[model samples]
Target: MDDQTDSPDDYHAICLGTAARARGIATRYVDGVYSRFHPFPSRWLALAAGGREYLFASGMLLLKGSDPWRGLGLHINEEATLLIRDKQRAKDFLDARGFGTPAGRVFRRGDLSAALDAFSSFAGPVCVKPNQGTKGELVFPAIADRARYESAVRRVAARHQKILVEESVSGQLIRFFFVRPRVVAVKLSRPASVVGDGSATIANLIEAKNALRDRRAVPGHSNIVVDEDLRDFLAMTGRSLDDVPAAAERVFLRGTSNGATGADSLGCRADLHPSYLDVLAAACNAVPGLNLTAVDVMIRDPAAPARHGNYWILEMNRNPGLTPYHFPWRGEAQDVSGAILDAMERGFAPVPASPPASVPASTHSMPAN
Candidate 1:
């Protein structure tokens, strides 16, 4: 795993496998193959065979022994998973509960006119994305006019029946990897960018950067793509591939900060404000049976104390990719997989006669969905 030779899915599996081995739990990939297409395995399975048999798939765990295992793994039920998948519904739920989430609306493909109307009502630029999208695909951000809004909606509608139009928040994207009762890791996502040299053209800098990425072969890091989108993004800034930027100037290559789309993932757990941690814990606890999740947030400054309007909860992920935390390009790697397994093992332990007094009261309650 340290060599970073495996894909994100393989890395996650390897991390779990390694942790399981240390716990004397036997494990193996069900198909003996790793999926290159998904952050998690589509078919990979981990089986712990000893006095008890445990099966793990895409963060779900099944225990088999004298007692039958419940369908939920890490206390994450199907209902909660489905709720989080529906971006609009999840945001509505959080908003109604006084959680800090962006105001947004959803429209079906046939309701393009309604979406446009809603976009106009927004005071600032809005983002158009699929209601059930992931990995930032089909997500168009920072649209300030009707033309871009309509085009973005139509483009998203081509792939999804429903689109989510929300006011775009200006900030850095941060991911908080939460396992019951705590955030195990935090990552800052930055779009693919290059610091300019005194004389090199933007095109040459991009080429060199891609070459470096190839040489380093950092798992889950994608090569900066040179495409129409990149060209358009540069054009918006009155520059082109041929332009030479002054030395030390950094030029971003993409607007979407997604790992699959050439974003740089940096582990920043140590730099996260304690207030944000409190907010994250409270947010995760608000959703019933949401034991393991990745909460994406937009914050102007992570070091600043979290306030009502300073940060917005983007969405929660049921199965977040662990590769970013394990192999961040700029900071210390975190053991998110290990924390997940720790939670699983804790689930199997016998309940104590009395709950620990030091444990916070919030941790004991699960809000009804």
Candidate 2:
């Protein structure tokens, strides 16, 4: 079923549902319902008949099959899932467990001066983002100075009441998608980029890229927009969209590696260091009751240990989209969605109960249908 936080035409839900049906399970999309709250209208889907049904208001999956057997949404229980939604809270939990995360502080809408004060001691650029944002919205990867930082703060603060300011970490971005205790999929993620062919301007390259991107676009995927934000990002790098570069040179179109922003995900599960498996497992265990999580990490080199303290855990996503790993633009395809269903059929022992006051009713796990 579709929910407010997700698009009614969610491709992840579609792919997973198809996978389920291929295994003899039944599934179908629920009719579309409109709402003024979302930027655009969205819908939900469900299994027409099956062993059982689990309905959630925040996610797009409506599973019905294998009675008495249930799949946790992304293999994450409701409590831990909600806990990880707050970036600050999730960072605190991981930090306490000895998983090294970037040092940062949370600032409310009115606290710009304090944020600036905290940034003064940081080296180089800073990352500013909404505390509970997803799909890379309002996440500024690099705010180089107080002027830019303040501007970003004001812009981001208007939409999000809480903001996170952290020292910018530089490196290749990698995501470890874990299924329970094991790392099931790994991907190298990058901001949307266009390669120059020695003949076309950057703007022309972008248009060409968009042409191809639109042809393959799904519900969550999108064509890159050459908007003011992208122009500003280019200006900061001493370049312009009208500039042309040498053949094979790549120009990044945006700072955030969000698929909706046209970021690319390349499968790299086999390329990860062996040591990373254990370290990532520790990262997952940091959150109690969390069975599935996508851990964002940055590293200077792929051949070395990412746990050397220099590398940082950017964020944790409990309800991570699975299609990116399943059908990457480059690299090998992984069956991350299939793995999720596999974990669900295995069953989850009840977790230690969380305090009632800390839990929200809307975040409650659905009963088996």
Candidate 3:
């Protein structure tokens, strides 16, 4: 056997298994890469959790839990989430069901002319990403010009056959985790940024920030990278790596608000409006059997009440991970896995109390060009 087990995927699995054990649920790490787990064998991997047998695969725990989604009749299985892996198809499905998303077009590989043409008339800032993407990989947020949009397309198209070019939605990347018809937890994610200490250059400041992040043994935290994206972002602001900003000034490093990309998260379940719950439930109902999922929403004004038609449902993540939610950077940890276990065992889990407030700033502005 190999002596090393440092893969992030394994780390995530261990975290999930640990969370399950805390809820008196046994877990076994299945060693298959496929999304579905039934065809292999019943004996290869099995667990008796909360007095129920479950099949585990690719960091997802499955069981014959009661249909917690009211009359939706969703079973706990990976098969129900396959459609969402294809982002464009998922958008089409949700759009057909009346869920509002940013309007944009999809481009195939080697179709630069068509993609640039679409970008020419694109209303405003755009977002470019792969049709089949995960963990915000190769996703360029807030693409404003044709050059950047084309560069983003090339980067994403190198790996994926098709790319999605959508209008950029402004606001906080707020996420709502639903365990079937109920919002279990809410998180506010912001792009990674560093506050200038006034003395250190941007390059040195980034180094210091990354050094601090690297010392931590957390699951989701990654060092803020110094790459072309960061360079371009800084250049747009008439700054460079060697420039030093005044103290208390904040400089954003990335456009995407994914924890894997060094973004900060705050637990904000208490601040969500009651109306947001209705919208979240509606998103779940859009896809039959999508009981347990996470809805990524872009709220223009997060401080205001989340009224219907005031937010955009970015996408519904099929198999949402619990590590980031459990070990947030600056907020009380959420027992998401525990809630799942409770829901499976008793058909319901009491919503956790709102943690201490750690709301992010009300707004984020683009770097001045």
Candidate 4:
């Protein structure tokens, strides 16, 4: 939206459309709202050939077909999306089922006093964010005092009625993009940062970094903004925009690790430890009707084998962005768009009756550490 060459939604649409066309399925944009597909019979179509509809946010819809709709990128359903969108509900569900999640509590508007009281109970730093928010908007992480805690609560409360206050877990933020039976791609993200060049001030370094991002013109990537929040974050570390950082010294510009906010995304699917696969698979399978999702996990060390109380599930994304995997700031690009289409095609195929197998309960546990 900030004069970018292309938005994440636009990039995803292009990738999906191209993949669909390659599969011999006619695809065209209808008023730039959604994709119209041919050879599918659906009442929502303007012509007889219109039977399938695909949107980046909402999943695919099949008109006059055996399956009516596939929510959240043609895999997750509406119920699951709604559940995942509400951070409190989703966290409760996962935490109850032995999935490691941050210990936190939710508060509604006008409950500021109670929220502050609960904040004091935490042993270490905490994260304050909207209960139902995305793209890391209005998320304040690593808050350690009463003053910052109160300010974060009031600020977030102004925009959202519900707020979630959770313990801040220290680890690398990794996103596991799970497509039903397997984890297709993994992304490691870091907060917006700039390395010091000795002579240039922080402000100049940020401008230079933004210029590089602009030149790269990577879809879905955003420039690091020199804003009040960034300035405040620097102030907390006793630094300012005018100060010159020593050469090779890296200064983080933000607390939230979001790609849209200039955070760096790196493809790490191949680097993920094998032990995490089981943990991620069990977590994804825990949610019924949730076939495709992006599971955000905080790990102290991803290279090491996963163990209980070593990681925490931050949240789950229903319609996870595909462009990040395809156009990361660093690392190899993954064909996530093609994988979604393949899953969609498989979903539409006739199902053969199979014996129902018992689902094993999760054995993992998260102790308060």
Candidate 5:
């Protein structure tokens, strides 16, 4: 995960997925984890603009990674970084909206010592997460003490250009997928999810997650790390997967978003929610230029409904994935992609001019020859 670049596999998948739908090709989404085992030519990463870029992979981090066009799609992928790559710029926008976000303190490890005591003053249990690392690989959240917090910062400092100690909010984790002005899907995430048959152990449940190679296993997270935090949570609850965690019951993951290793996505259509729509509309106007983003939010209590009063905007995903936002099964909710593709094909709504003139300029200029 380079700061200036996106993971090749992640970028390539988006491009191919987008173009495949656009071109009417026999579309086949590939699994990234399994694909890595195959052979390929030299990998490439580049920036593209103004047209549909294409690449392949059901989506995974394949090492023998063959698809050479990964780099070529970087341009379209740049849309994703519109709100992410520049941390300061993103935080400033969120802070202006009256939403509580990570009170990120950017500093070198050496200077952090002097600022340590003060930083903890904002809130206790600050996290030392790399401004760039993926998953929870390099993030050290919950530094209850200053010494330990500083140490975590130093470790990260060795590798990163800067470190961010974010304010930790503990509660049910939620992720909201937005495509510009429209919020496609909002899911309440479980850090890690597994079904219980009243027999399998926690480890067994993990095995079950890993075993489903064909469908359930998502790329970038094919394997679950039964790290110390998970162990501690299991112990704290005085329970194990053997205790028969409720059917569709979630085993809580400590220090993570509902132990959600990406499974807690519950589809929500803000357009359908009246009260929430008001908030979304306000937010859209505030960030006028942003289109297509998945914003993470922490709703102290979400068991009720996704009505206003409780919604808080987290960071935005300029290029949110279409799969999670779309309905996976039959007849539940409208698939987000169907709407997005409809918009993409039917074309963006004609932007009315300020004076309501005879006709406004082309809203989305078609790609050049």
Candidate 6:
């Protein structure tokens, strides 16, 4: 049955409609109308019917005998890669697919000791983070001493029941946006610092930082007040409001921070570098189930991305922030919605029509020609 409904919430359906329109195909969106009809076998109810029987239909209802119910279409799907949200599983899957991903290990909470020992073989500080965390919420790194590592572990453990510890990596933080296997945009989040004049206090410096941040585009890190970590960082350095850093003195509140600081980041390196395609392809193959996942990758260097070494994939995002694709930035469309629609249409459509079986004489009288 042809269906048309007005609902902006159904992104998949909307994309299908948009794609169909772009391709010059006549299409309609049907929402909730299927429930109005009796749930009888489709073949019985879908027999070619007279126009009078469908007088109340919003659009033409294809009968089983002739139409075979193949016209149904939808916008999104449950099977898309968007459903695969786990961190370690995503990495293993990506690595198997030949994607240049980080070197690390995943273990259950009980087995963290062994995992830690295994990483000790490598020379470098290790980072500890929660398996599922928003932004850099539970991420900490560059920890060498065992006591500090234990402290960080305790703090992280208090917040989360489980955590992950891996080798510390030094590189540029880049977010590669993807829909399924396609890369749409590359955003480089550089760990940057800003200096303050001698006149402003540390508090005032932060306030000025926040004032310069662009709220409409990227939320400025400056707007985010000093957390416990920032406070501790300030205290350990023995600096207060009176001491002003050298003019344009670079001060880093976050060691691995690349996103917005106090000011909105300029589009200094907005374009995607040409070298990240191989890693992107490997990431897509790694998670076969994900429909759309943004792979958070760390490259030692972008100019020599591959030459530097394998790009470590921090994690694969399942439910990515969607606005960046079309709203403010007008990022490229992966057209994943269209792919979902195609899958839904093929999946939900009824079995194709076959030769009608010869039936016994009907009890009802047949009209004589």
Q: Which ten-residue region of model 5 has the weakest summed lDDT?
A: 360-369
- The 0-to-1 C-alpha lDDT of every candidate, in the order given, reads 0.73, 0.69, 0.67, 0.73, 0.48, 0.48
Judged by lDDT relative to the true structure, which candidate is superior, 2 or 3? 2
Question: Model 6: per-residue lDDT, tens digit, 74-112?
Answer: 111123323244565555655544455555554456655
| Tens-digit per-residue lDDT, 138-230, candidate 3 | 988787878888888888888988889988888778888888657778898878788898899988988888888777766677778888877
Model 5 TM-score (2 dp): 0.61
What C-alpha lDDT, on a 0 to 100 scale, does residue 118 get in candidate 4? Answer: 80
lDDT per residue (tens digit) for residues 282-317 in model 2: 667546677767889886666676554556778888
Clashing residue pairs in candidate 2 are 1-62, 2-44, 8-43, 51-65, 53-369
Better of 3 and 4 by lDDT: 4
- The local lDDT score (0 to 100) that residue 34 gets in candidate 3 is 29
lDDT of 5 by residue, 149-241 (tens): 766677787887667767655555556655445655566554555666666766787777667733654333334557765665565456654
- Candidate ranking under lDDT, highest first, comes to 1, 4, 2, 3, 5, 6
Query: What clash pairs does model 4 have?
Result: 40-51, 42-63
lDDT of 6 at 95: 53
Per-model TM-score, in order, reads 0.83, 0.83, 0.80, 0.83, 0.61, 0.59
- Candidate 3 deviant stretches above 4 angstroms: 1-9, 33-46, 62-79, 96-98, 346-369
lDDT of 1 by residue, 206-269 (tens): 9898899898887779898888877876865578999999999999877789877889998776
lDDT of 4 at 293: 79
